[model samples]
Target: MNVNEITPFIGLELSDASYEDLVRPEVWEQLVQGVQERELVVVRGIELTPQQQIDLAARLGEPVPFLISKYRHPEFEQIMISSNEMKDEKPIGVARVGNFWHQDSSFVADPAPYTMLHGVNVPGTSGHTKFANAADVYDRMPEEWKAKLSDRIGLHTVGKRLRIRQEHVGLSVAEFKALIDIEHPKVEHPVVCKDEYTGREYVYGSREYMDSVLGFDPNENEAFFTMLDGLIHDETHVYTHKWTPNDLVIWKTRTTYHIATEVEPGASRTVHRVSIETRRP
Candidate 1:
């Protein structure tokens, strides 16, 4: 297989390989290693049916079950469908699942370490997946900023995400938060986290999930977190992928953050998402 770099810090696109080759143990191991080394892996020119996608994802890692009931595939509970197409006056799949910067499952105490997306149908113009390397961002931080974040912990919340998502779709955040407290008060995680696999440190903060930072007053927390967000999104540390059909991409959750861009209205983009059950270090 041939590998191409999209950016110096983040993406490596693998080509000249088939789906059959990807499922092999040796290729899978190499793919995993590539993802760890580059933070993001994109394999092109492979197509898979829904069942094939599910089975293949299982070979790579445990496919975490879909939390959103409405988005679950009819046959596979572990596969979540993201699409804008409709059938018989009803939505065929979930659209705009994640519009903000986040690492999948970051709101939980044990966040998933890997997230994979298999592109079934993607728009050529828009619908890009943007990635940010937190490790590199942290490495480039000013000394004082690094020192300030050394002892700080971030308060993350799932409820806030649900609230924001509901609000985005024209629902009341308060009503959604009251009906279900799936994500309770909040969870505390260190601002600076060490990746167990790479032995590298990264600034781990999500603007969508982080409620506040401990040891800092409200204003200070806001300012600091905002600055950190800017750093994480800095162009030098970011890579945006314009997906093609049958492309499969995976990113390490602990060392990177990603967000989905808006697709054109009336356009459909569908992907089967899989998240590894292994906990982030």
Candidate 2:
């Protein structure tokens, strides 16, 4: 079937399902093509062994930048993302924590191009991520909203992006800021970004953080700002992924917004994260 026919089955998946291909041509398959403008593409049910995970990523595209290991495995570059409930990976990670939604590698120049995650150890209680499709969002937005967003250029800073990360890692806000500087133009892209491949558009920007910064003005546009966030949170446009053991999902950072759910006080969710570097920045 053409992509049009398959677009409707996006969020449906069977927890026990497994697949070999990076993207299945089936309706809900993770491998999607045809559009040059879609904001996000989620492939559910790709269970890869640690080695297979690396191989599969290589097949899909080039690998993205990863954090330098103060404490790294022999194959640190290929080491998938991981974490624990109580606290693990000491010395270096004595204070390490779970990751949050922000473009990957924003700490350095030319952050990762895409982020792909695979479930390693998922506690039954809580662990999931929510994604907002920027391309679809822009397509559905009012022309005026689109115009306003287009006219404005945004500033992305490592400091602001890491706010949620700090919170998730259980670090104090003061400590978080102390570790990272709020770098300028962390990514100065448009709020409404289009998918270079699919040519689709979506609203980009961390609403909570962006609005918080726009606290630049004492009189904030709280009401209007919130309404925009509501659009992404709306059931019709949002996809909440409840991860299962062995599930592998890949999304293009350029056109997708994802929130890696931090485990509640009692639960834990762990996964391997890899970023794909693109030819463009």
Candidate 3:
């Protein structure tokens, strides 16, 4: 895999990525639009535990303190998703199986730019996460709809939005509700986020979990959430992932939306997740 010999994946525009060891330089010269050093390359082989995952993420960049959950792993609480296993051991905000989708650390002042997940002892057919192509969603937005949302920001509160699951998964009722009052700016970044290296901008956030869009009236919560959510729910613009043991997926966090696919009882799936905070933010 020579750094100069990179080629595009069928559906993906691989112009920005160069394999460090790839030797076929001619294969990649034609498609690459631009190249910004890739921050990560998924490594497969030895099973990765929480700490092991942290170590690998360290190679790409320093861990940006896991910001989503109140609980922290002594060294690092890299985002992780586990099913059937006791939820307390991992940093999943919503454990068990469910249909919830969200961005990492959006509620916090700074969110991560990338995330890495390594699957271990995965179940036969459970716990695969689906990542929607934010870019596709943004392109489909009607120009008027885009203008309406262009400058808005949304308030996201973990405890307020997913209370029951928070409690069931081990968060204390009192602690979970406390977060609802926190409001986050509903930033309308470029609808399509061009990869700094690939020049491909992807839609990274959604309205379904939005608390408010800048000036949206609080009393009209339903109208606001519904109006924008309907746009994202149109279903033609999303990607769902099914996990495989030893499989690793690293993604551009700033421009993607992901959700945990629940595992049925008597079945189990576990994953270790790590996130990198952008130096710019």
Candidate 4:
């Protein structure tokens, strides 16, 4: 296998490995190591069926289904479908999700430590996923800020963002409310988290789900988020992955924040996602 760095710190691209080679224990171990150290790994030019993809995710960790029930694959609960396609005038999958910066399942008590996406159908003109290395962001933070936020906890919920997504998909207010009524547990995590595997500290909250930092007033929390946004967006800490059909991208969730760029209107983009559950450190 050949490995190339996509950026100085954020992404690694692994190529020249066949499906047979990838399923080997030693090769999978090296890929996991690459993800832990580089934050993201893109395996290029490999083909796999849906079952094969889920099997690969299982090798990494327990494959977990997404919370959104409607978007999950009908046959395989472990896979979530993100697409712009429709069947019989109904969306086949969730459209335009992850357009904002956030971590997957951050509001849950046991968040996924790894997230993998297979680009099944990609638009030629656009459709790129951008990632920011939160570990690097924490390292570059001001000492005073670090000291203040080191032990603080962040309150996270799917609150308003759920409403936003509901509107995007044209769901009625009543339907939207019913989904939120299902009693999602309140979640809180350290603003600065230490990765159990690598012992690296990273910023753990994003603007979407993180309502506030515990013990901080609204103004202070807002200021903190604003500062974090700037640092995460800094060119040195960011990597943009242009999607191609059959590209399998995986990233260490605790160490990075990601967003999907807008695709051209009427463009078709379908991606299948699998997330592996891991307990919080």
Candidate 5:
């Protein structure tokens, strides 16, 4: 296998390997190490069937099934790759999912440690995914800032993103929440949390998922979160990935936050996504 560093802190791209090679202990070790060190790792030319994808995910950790029924694959409930490509003048899959910057399932009590996406139909002109190294951002923060956030916690909720998505999809918040079996009450996580595997600390939630910072005046809370958003998303700390067919991306949720960059309306950009539980870490 050949490895290329996409960015200093954010991403790694591995080539010259096939899907069959991934199950090997050595190759799987490399995949795990890549995700641990790089936060986001993308391997090219590994086309996976739904079962193959699920099998690969299981190798890393327990697979978290997609809770949203609209996005779930009809044949395989574990895979959820939605696209704007129409079938009979209606959308077959969800579009612009995770367009906002966030760590997957961070609003929940126990969030997933990793998110894996297998590229199926990548749009030619657009549809890039940008990742930020939250750990790196936290490391560069000033001592004063770190001290202020040392004991701070932020409120996170699915309702935050739900509101934005509902505006575009035309579903009421109650209707939207009712469609998914996942329970997303407002939850709080430390502003900076330590990664169990690496023992390194990273800023946890994002503006998209976090409703507010706890124990601060409203103005102070907004300012702090605004500052956090600016620092964590600064271009220097980010890496943008351009996708190719059969490119599988695995990203560590504890160390990074990611966003789906734009694609044209109705353009096809399908990817099968699954989550690995943080419990093993």
Candidate 6:
């Protein structure tokens, strides 16, 4: 197998290997280590069935099912389909997901540490995913910013996103609140978190889910977070991956934030995703 850096700091691309070659114990170990260190790893030139993808995820960590049942693969619950396809006038899978920068499962108490996606169908142009290395961003941040956020906690919730969706579907505010209270209550996590395996510190919140920084003046919270957002999303710290069929992309959740770009009109794209529970170091 040939390994290439997608960028100096953020991503690694492993090519010239098949799925069989990657599942070998030693190779798999190196692949996992590469993702933890580099933040994102893309394995090119290998097509995976839904079962194969789930099996590969299990080798890395426990493959957990997504919260939304509609997106789960019909045959395999662990595979969540992200597609713009339609079946019987309904979306076959969740469409236009992750259009904003965020970490997977951050609003939950036990966030998944790894997320893997296998591109099954991809557009010839204009459907790409962008990732930013939070660890790298944190490392270069101004000292005062680091000191201010070091001991801070962030309030995270699915409320904002859910509220928008509920409005589109005409759900009442009281009903929306009831649903959120049951399924996705607000949670808190450190603004700066350390990787258990590597001891690397990274900025841990995103505007998509993180509502505010605890103890900060409410009036000042927006400005404070906006400043952090600018630093976190600087283009120099980001790598954009153009999707291709058979590319299996994986990234460490605690170390990176990712967003999906717009797909071209009338273009078709489908990807299967799996989020793995925190793995032991």
1-281, model 1: which lDDT tens digit per residue? 89788788888888878878888898888888888888889998588777777776676567878887778888888878888877788776788678888877677787777788888889988898889888888888889889988978988886656635544465475756655454365778899988777788887777788888888898988888678778877876788888888898888887878889999887888888877775324
In the range 115-188, model 6's lDDT, one tens digit per residue, is 99999998858789999888887888889888888789999987767636534467677976777878778999
Model 2 regions lying over 4 Å from their true place:
1-46, 68-74, 85-109, 161-186, 208-225, 279-281
Q: Regarding lDDT, does 1 or 3 come out ahead?
A: 1
Q: Considering TM-score, where higher is better, how would the candidates rank from best to worst?
A: 6, 1, 4, 5, 2, 3
Per residue, candidate 4 scores C-alpha lDDT tens digits across 1-281 of: 89889988688898877778888888888898889888899998678888999999988888887778999988899999999998899998988799988887788876778999999988756889989988888989999999999789999887757645434377577866565646554589989988876788899988887888999998999899899989877766678888877899999887788989999997999999999876334
Look at candidate 6 and tell me the lDDT of residue 178: 77
Instruction: List all candidate RMSDs to the true structure.
Output: 3.1, 5.8, 6.7, 3.4, 3.5, 2.3
Candidate 3: where is the Cα deviation over 4 Å? 1-52, 64-81, 86-94, 162-204, 218-224, 279-281
Weakest 10 consecutive residues of candidate 3 by summed lDDT: 2-11
- Clash pairs, model 5 backbone: none
Error of 5 at 16 (Å): 1.6
In model 1, the runs with Cα more than 4 Å from the true position are 163-183, 279-281
lDDT of 2 by residue, 82-171 (tens): 565233534322123333444344334455566667777776556677776656556767777666566465555556444354234876
Cα lDDT, all candidates: 0.80, 0.54, 0.51, 0.85, 0.81, 0.86
Worst 10 residues of 6 by lDDT: 162-171
Better model by lDDT: candidate 5 vs candidate 6: 6
The most accurate candidate by TM-score is 6
- Taking the tens digit of each residue's C-alpha lDDT, what string does model 5 give over 182-207? 54578888988887767788888787
Better of 4 and 6 by TM-score: 6
Segments of candidate 4 deviating more than 4 angstroms: 164-182, 278-281
Which scores better on TM-score, 1 or 2? 1
Q: What TM-score fits each model?
A: 0.90, 0.69, 0.65, 0.90, 0.89, 0.93
Angstrom error of the Cα, residue 30, model 5: value is 1.0
